[model samples]
Target: MLIEVEVCDVCRRLGVPVTSYTITETESGRSVVTVRCGEHAAPFEEVLGQPVEAVAAAETPKPRQAKKAATGRQPRGQRAERQVMTREQIDAAKAAGKA
Candidate 1:
């Protein structure tokens, strides 16, 4: 038996994972593709002169998100908008020498 199997349109276009394939043997003596799901039953005929069955099952890889840029510098703006530190706070920090 000779059959042609390709990536299903729904699976390819809609980005659906083709973990399982739904095949129906029609009266026309040709295998027709119906759908592809996450899992399916088997009775698949290995067609002659066709590509070997895929060893790896279809699965949707996890989507990757782009990383954000690091920021260490302060934004440019008016100095008046910045809060003023108290003299006591500055003195205490200087005395402790932590900053």
Candidate 2:
């Protein structure tokens, strides 16, 4: 089951996953719930002027996916065969070009 989970708003800025933190609500007309890592609770409160709700346990974010392997190599084919020209044929072509 896919559940919508809240991650640490602060840690998310750094693209890191945090599992433990305290939750707090932002003090504004539009109330927003901001989750913070263990160390960010005080900062969030001080910055957002919000009060802490409670400390809770959150699941660690799933590991980032690895870069996908390259698709199949570019298609290739054998070069077309070249015409076999003798010295006489070459001289004839050169002579024709001079005409």
Candidate 3:
């Protein structure tokens, strides 16, 4: 799921790695943003230490599956031999009137 939110200026100032942040919405219509900074973890219950509006979680659409080549056909190296008549064979067959 994708959750979009305005990054806090403080977090931006701290150079908080965005990859460690997560967003989740509860059944009560409340959104939670979890931040991990090294070994420390915190949840946003307030903005600037004051109770704030709830943030909604964003839903991401399922990704499409990649197409793959079909299996089970023989490889080129394992295919049956192609008909290739040698020069002597052709000459002999022509001399025998079977060309």
Which candidate gets the maximum TM-score versus the true structure? Answer: 2
25-88 in candidate 1: lDDT tens per residue?
Answer: 5566666555543332222332323344442222335689975544764445423366678999
Show the lowest summed lDDT stretch of 10 residues, model 1: 40-49
What stretches of model 1 exceed 4 Å from their correct place? 1-71, 74-81
Local error of candidate 2 at residue 43 (angstroms): 2.5
Give candidate 1's root-mean-square deviation (CA, Å): 15.7
Q: Which ten residues in a row have the lowest lDDT in candidate 3?
A: 51-60
**In model 1, which residue pairs have backbone atoms overlapping below 3 Å?**
none
lDDT of 2 by residue, 9-48 (tens): 6665444444453344556545445566556666544544
lDDT of each: 0.49, 0.56, 0.53
**Order of candidate numbers by TM-score, starting with the best:** 2, 1, 3
TM-score of each: 0.20, 0.25, 0.19
For residues 14-89, what per-residue lDDT tens digits would candidate 3 score against the true structure? 5444334545555666665554443243344233244343232123356899755458766544666687999999
Residue 26's lDDT within candidate 3 is: 56
RMSD of each: 15.7, 18.0, 14.3
By lDDT, rank the candidates, best first: 2, 3, 1
TM-score head-to-head 1 vs 2, winner: 2
What is the Cα-based TM-score of model 3?
0.19
